[model samples]
Target: MPSEAPPTDFSVARIHETVLQMLGAGVLPPVVQAGHPVLRQAAALFDGQLNAEELGQLIHLMRSVMRRAPGVGLAAPQLGIPLQVAVLEDEFDVDPEAAAVRGREPLPFFAMLNPHVRPSGTASVAFYEGCLSVNGLQAAVARPENVEVDFTAPDGTRQQRSFSGWQARIVQHETDHLHGILYLDRAELRSLSNNAEYSARWAQPDIGRARQELGFLPG
Candidate 1:
């Protein structure tokens, strides 16, 4: 007798059942922390891994978690699902000078499925970044100031757009999550600081000050 082919429908159904069960049970697990293996592994492409209703539940769960975590972004790997999905939104609560320098602005919530991001220009900028997974720490990381992003929208439409400034940073960070990359990987390690210390010392939008103080050049 030949070996049986794996039941792909059964697998997808199992995942769907598990996700819905968690949501229906109203017992959402905390976001997966940094040391988890899921965070280190590249997430799977989100090809119909979830049906419409299941995807909605997952997105709702993610949106709620990100907002409550009070974070600007959250990725599926952060929830231990290991799918290439993430959500991002920024309320833009900074002072005028900071907002202007960083090009910060209010960003409505958006979901990215199987996102791909690439640099749109050679210009790069550095900023202090923190993640919900790696709580209580911020570090300086330089990235392309503009990027082109391609992803699937919630309604199942394929989309592509360009982003710049702070929004670009957010997109890159979340996309990196899908690729098993963390800001810490590209961060100027010397510029690492606790949240309070970061606020007290390097809160300025200019990261050059942090580079001077921390004795490392921005990437």
Candidate 2:
């Protein structure tokens, strides 16, 4: 018998569609959680100037796929590229569609080029967070309820903004990816999802508002 060829990995487009189909079909494949080598590797920085043309393309692509999948957020790593950038729900409390609906207004999409965060005050403890990489699994990660974050805008203009609640969580989460750290590595894995002998699923410094009360936190 001829040797069987290894199954071809799904294309990003196919994976994007599959995620969408699952959403429409009401069956989401457990996202490949941490432990995958891709998730562990540190992502490279975006040195190329993401001009209006490139930024627009990336934003459009991310938004399109994100809607099809109906996720609260999606990172570059999930798409198989190790770029230090991501797009997420800046306003976690609002309906996910709102980001699209609000257009470039109050709830416009966030395109972070190079992000760095600094905390100014004590962070509130909350729980309930999930990762696109870790499908079907969720955890409680403590994050600063509020903080000052400085990052480069898609326009290449430097900007500093203070965000709290769900917004803060999204920024922090994506930044961690740039350093090869997963939410699970930064969340309080031991406290929230503890089982007798097994290792915890979350990391430390978990203080985002993805806690149970948000009611919009993704799984």
Instruction: Quote each prediction's TM-score.
Output: 0.90, 0.63
Regions of model 2 farther than 4 Å from truth: 1-33, 49-52, 90-107, 190-219
RMSD of each: 6.2, 11.6
State how far residue 88 of model 1 sits from its true place (Å).
0.9
Candidate 1: where are CA atoms >4 Å away?
A: 1-14
The digit string of per-residue lDDT tens for model 2 on 75-158 reads 665655555567865334544443332221233577776678877698554555666676555556667777787777777788
Tens-place lDDT digits, model 1, residues 123-205: 98888899988988999888999999999998889999899999999999998888777788888899999999998999997
Model 1, residue 209: displacement in angstroms?
A: 2.1
lDDT of 2 at 168: 71
> lDDT for model 1, on a 0 to 1 scale?
0.83
Clashes of each: 0, 18
The Cα local distance difference test for each model comes to: 0.83, 0.57
RMSD of 1: 6.2
